[model samples]
Target: MAAQASGDLSLVGISKEFETFTAVHPLDLEVPAGSFFALLGPSGCGKTTTLRMVAGLEEPTTGKILIGDQDITDTKAFRRNVNTVFQSYALFPHMTVLENVAFGLKRRGDKDAVAKAKESLELVQLGAVAKKKPAQLSGGMQQRVALARAIVNRPDVLLLDEPLGALDLKLRRQMQIELKRIQSEVGLTFIHVTHDQEEAMTMADSIAVMNAGRIEQQGDPASLYEHPKSVFVANFLGQSNLLRASIEGPGAEGTVMVSSHGQRLEADASHIPEGAREIWLGVRPEKLRLGEGGGPNRLHGVVADASFTGVATQYLVRLPWDQEITVVQQNDGSARALEGENVTVSWASHHGFVLDAAEPADAGLGHEDG
Candidate 1:
């Protein structure tokens, strides 16, 4: 798989509407040349719709799209230099893998279409199965054929809409790495759409988190995970215990004193408004230390439940206000606490993130509008 020269992609105030329902809100995004970017959200978050508009498959109700400085908003799907690997793989069952891969090149009337198709099949490591129909291949192999078909034309951008959605868990994990490798080899700007947070975190250089047709946050995975901007982002990105807190007074480093479950805790809040009295504090389960801890934020709780995973143990601790906080502990030689045991949970002050208390717009699940 020879890498294609990189190209830039831009979406400016793009929006899509079907009758009275707005499937995608006006949004702007810029994907740098050769970057592996992901649009991540639960189903119905408009990630797919946004991807469709960028691929020229769906006309935006407003705004413009650009590929390598070329205005492509009004361009037809076939005219644009972009290819999409749909969720369904969409391979022609009757056509052999070789012919299916060669289909796009045949339409372009390329003289070396058949040879190029063979080369692409080899790139995807599917040349050995070239003579077999899609029905004869495994789901992963079929997906590879679909990928070969799309890349055989060597488009400027490759849009992957849940390309690994059909595979089983183990296969999906394997395909994530494969997809990343292929994207790197192709050097095409890969814009992937997926609802799986772990998938997005593993493969993307940057992620755009969408909610209810609007982008909630966009950043590198580390930044998004460490400093989520809203409650929705904090909860959606991974498991986190959200605790209701009331700001009390000024504290160290421009932080404010907050009270939660009758315990006073200090946290940095230079970014938060001074007079704002109430906020939701987000603490990752892994950040919480169990038993008598020596951290900045400490609290007493009773173990409500415990579950043992292969590598770690999960404990649900009940607080004074009936709030449940989850804690994850590595499975080491240390004795694991049983359910109904009294325990103290603690974490560093820096580990907590304060989010505004508000219900985000409902983002539905999976290709509803499309």
Candidate 2:
């Protein structure tokens, strides 16, 4: 079977409301053709609602959804050139894997359904198990079957709503790689909705972090991780040590001075958010290095706790201001800190990220006034 021509997806001022409750605020978003896009957020943050709107399963309260040049907001679910894979595999219990994969094509009156299904099964590495029933397959195999069933139809866009949620941790990780590989080989536009940060980061070409019916940040995973604009994004996407500090204006050689608890630190001014005064200086735990001296961006603290993980050592340091900061260093077999010893934490100026101190107006502020 020929592959479906991929199309870019567009949501223009889309919003959803349930009587007095608003699930999604007015939003505009775009997914490029043949790109792996992820809508990442916690539960009730409207990621699923937005996906359902794209799938035509939930009607948008306002605005239009488009696929390339065609308006699909009001189109019926089955009439649109799109397919959805839910968390549940939803395979037919009694039907063989091949039959289940070919069912959609058969219903559409395609004469070569079985042959196409076999090809899809091979794409997902389940061609040998085509004769097995859903009950006979493992959770991972059943998921591959489900994916085969969806991709067999060769839809213009594929919507995945936490399809790997049912798999175990190891299986989930494996499927994440599998799914990305399949998507790349097929060149399909895949819009994935997931609450798992790791899953989104691992699979998506680009990600939009949603919270309280709004997008807190959107970019490639590295960009978002290295420079988060808001506190919600800094804390949500990964573990960040956010220190309350006031910008003491510009420093020498393109650096900005930040004062926290009488200690002055310098950060790359280019990375600081525009118009931010009192800011939260963010540094990933893994970016911090432990030593015993004052430096450009340094903090002196006492080692409160330390844990030895296989890949690295995790340290909890108590600062003079009665606050704790976490640090992670690679297990390079160097001098380690004792629990009661005082230590200095240091990082390069370029590694620091500055975020606005004030929370977003709608962040945990509830729904907008009607």
Model 2, runs deviating above 4 Å: 1-4, 292-295, 360-370
Q: Provide the lDDT at 319 for model 2.
A: 96
**lDDT scores of the candidates, listed in order:** 0.85, 0.88
Model 1 TM-score, all chains together: 0.92
Each model's TM-score? 0.92, 0.95
How many residue pairs clash in all the candidates, one count each? 4, 0
lDDT of 2 at 179: 96
What digit string (tens of lDDT, one per residue) describes model 2 on residues 1-370?
Answer: 3355656898999999999899999999999988899998888899999999989899999999999999998899989989999999898998999999999999989999999999999999999999988999999999989888988888889999999998899999999999999999888889999988899999999999998798888999999889887877777777888888899988989899999889999988998878889888889998898983324688889999999998899999999998899999888988889898999999888888887888642233222310
- Cα lDDT of model 1 by residue, 1-370, tens digit: 5665445898999999999789998999999888899999878789999999988888999999988778999889988888999879888878999999998788878999999999988888898998999999999999999999988888888899999988999999998998888888877788999988999999999999998899999999989998888777777788778777888887887677898868898777754533557777778899899965746788888999999998999999998778888999999878998898888898877888877655432212223321
Candidate 2 local lDDT, residue 15: 97
Give every collision pair in model 1.
43-364, 43-365, 43-366, 44-364
